[model samples]
Target: MSSLDAEPHAPGADAPRSPGPLLAIESSCDETAAAVIAADRSVLSSVVSSQAALHERFGGVVPEIASRAHVERILPVIREALAEANVTPTDLSAIAVVTHPGLVGSLLVGVTAAKTLAAVWDLPLIAVDHLRAHLYACRIAYGEEAFPACGLVVSGGHTNWYDCPDAVRATLIGSTIDDAAGEAFDKVARLLGLPYPGGPSVQQAAEHGDPTAVPLPRPMMNRPELAVSFSGLKTAVRYAALGNPNSPEVPAPPLGERRIADLAASFQAAAVDVLVGKCDLALKQTGRPTLLVGGGVAANRALRVGLTDLCERRGVRLCIAPMELCVDNAAMAGLAWESFERGEFAPLDCDVTPGLVRA
Candidate 1:
């Protein structure tokens, strides 16, 4: 039986009883997070311990360091989540954890912690795909009304198009054939002397800049495939910033408020333009009337504005997770509700699948 079929008694005819509340864990990357959500899909409490400061000095996240950080924060984060929700192990009917498609060591910490909790409390266990959870993160942020639409996930780790039927199932349509969009952002940001986590830094700098100032090529723009490629753009941006004579790419020397903002604006424009074009193609191909965007890079204000504008002009409804949920959080574990109803408990055999999916 599904959680939807488990709701309590109705007025006249008996309604289904709701499955018990769920405790969800997420350690897919640098964040150690936990959440308690009810069968009705209400998030009771959510806690996230971020390791951005730990990784900032390195220019990017080191997988091993991220894993260690998860270990340090997992227990405390969960305890905080439970306390904030005013729930105990005895109150939770199931436990759900993200177990795949992320940094291997990082994923293990979450899977191990979740498995231990399930065993000690004798509760059902669920495994959630990290990327899928990103999509569900939208449902949590926008409510169920935001589900069942085609979604475009763009972040440092991924960029893809999906035919989302619901929270648990998504049909992949388009994805990057080379470096992910977020990876490109970081590379470009580094070249520009922007801080780590390039997406935001680049976006901030781009606000006042003229995107037209940099005549960067839009790779795969007219391509027959729906795939995206940002490696060339990143390279172009780098050559421009360094004033490499061999490279045709050119840019005003990085300086002054206006110049910095214009470059930032240009870079952001190029990235978002490609993203929006692909989304337009996806909508045309799938014929889906709604569009949803999520993941860490989804928090980019410029990207959001561009996507929203394209969606509006194309007559497609747009849905995005709130800025807080757009990054990483445990509230996205749809498996919580799934496990509660099906009682599909994981055995001791449960283990993390780091390479859960390529894109």
Candidate 2:
């Protein structure tokens, strides 16, 4: 049992005399994070403990390693969040946690911690969807003006778009049928002998290279459907970086720094082209006034430039989360406040939804 179980659940016994901030926790994947947000949606503190180095040897995030790290770092992260916000648990109104569309064990860690704190403090508990939080990050950055927009979330595990009608509710309109764009980035990076956390590494490499030097495929970019595919693109990158074994010229040449840079630029361009095409198609189909982009891949400079140019041409206002809020973090838990406003709290027995949310 948690040591917190020993605390009594007195509804108003230790309640603050005034309304205060909400404690939000996020352990959806490799990052264990926490934040304190005020009643006015101001983030007082946000702390994230990353397990990137721990998973670097594996070239990708391992679920088991991620969950175990969460178990060890969650408390310290939360304590830091609270301290930085200059608030104690007794001064909070409620607690929130991401409980869906993430690694099951990682989600459970945050949920269990949030639930324990909520019970011990006699405060309400809120459940936030991971994807929904990503979308809400745009809202937090741009205020109410960012809503009723088309939201695209591009992370290592998710590549999906939503028809967002409001703050708390959004309908999935499209998604990846095969590998996510970010996943393609990671696998392609490995093919090039690039570092882990492929998105940033690839982006950095692409800077000194020519994006047109590679003939990578832009899978499904020509299709009218909103769904996308990146597996073929990744395979094309593999062939370009490493000679195909079926060919007699397999020993043509090894990947040099210049060649790696060129390949990275080409792969990034192809991926961003498909993404930009989809965004253009989504706007044409939905006619939404705003385009809101979030998630880790949304932090890509190429993507940001592509999206900015697309919005300008289409006369669509672009709203994006600040770079700090682009990655998975507790501060993006802005959706929880929307739920709290509607009194749509979750039950204490709520469980995590472990799979990617299908459109």
Candidate 3:
């Protein structure tokens, strides 16, 4: 589930469950997460250890720090997930981990652990694409109906939309030419002197301010295709909050609490507008009747509202990942079942392909 999407079942639901589950590890970024999901989609236990605190002082994720933390927490988090699920490694059908399109160091932590466990336990090893896993969160929420839909995967490292023909297939339609929306939020927040991990910070401040207070630009709006842009928008926020660096005539105003709020509201509104606007175009181009949105930024309240409104007006079906599944978590690794059944296993020597956004 995209924390940006909405789902209902609580994590680690306690009740008599399936015989075997796939143990999944997700250390693709700053979060060290593990989960046990049965073939029947029974999410026995999902655990995540975030290194947000460690990265907060740095303004963003530091690759080296994230990798080290993952090494420290992956095993413990996996142990906790198994304990909560009431299962052992031998009880799992396979070992799965997100192995691509993320920080190489962070991805390696999870991949190495999964491979070691798989080899030690004699279990099948499955590698999951980080982007596909985000899409699978929709399937975990909506079942088979989530397929043949338009998917928008928005996160810190990705802001690309796809035409998903099934759980295992996606075709890139359009994407950001520069910074992803989450990056824009972070940089804009810093411009406004807000806290790190800007999506939540900006969303919070935006609640009390007017969205129209500052006139922000929405780049690449009329480009017929689904191509999206946010770098220009972020620069616009910077100029609005701090006077143009090269200008000498006018001095930048102080960022009072209220002024910050207004700028936050305006920047968020512009970003959401472009994000939702692209979704509108994606649906038209793909001729798909459903829209599936996942990724960390999908959690933005304003973006969700905009997507809901877009689907409603277009008479399109909407399936979003639940709040718990929304952020990077193991429950979504339920997709591993598909690969396992299809006999698609990863070699122990496989390495992570970081920052590789499949075009």
**Best by the lDDT measure:** 2
The residue-by-residue lDDT of candidate 2 on 1-359, one tens digit each, is 33333344455465446567899999999999999998778899999888989988898999999999999999989888887887777667789999988999999999999998888778899988899899888888888888788989999999998888778668889999999888988898888889988999999999989999978888889898999999888878877777766785665356999999999999999999999999999888878999989899999999999999999999999997899998899999967888887889999999999986654
Q: How big is the positional error of residue 331 in model 2, measured in Å on the Cα after superposition? A: 0.5
TM-score of candidate 3 on Cα atoms, chains taken together? 0.93
Per-residue alpha-carbon lDDT of candidate 3 for residues 76-145, written as tens digits (9 for 90 to 100):
8988898899876646778899988889899998999888777767677898888888888989888888
Q: In TM-score terms, which candidate is top?
A: 2
The lDDT values for all models are 0.79, 0.88, 0.86
- TM-score of candidate 1 against the unseen true structure: 0.90
- Per-candidate TM-scores read 0.90, 0.95, 0.93
How many Å off is the CA of 350 in candidate 2?
0.6
Give me the runs in candidate 1 sitting further than 4 Å from their true place: 1-17, 245-258, 356-359
lDDT of 3: 0.86
User: What would the C-alpha RMSD of candidate 3 be, to one decimal place?
Assistant: 6.7
Residue 229 error, candidate 2, Å: 0.6
Off by over 4 Å in 2: 1-18, 250-252
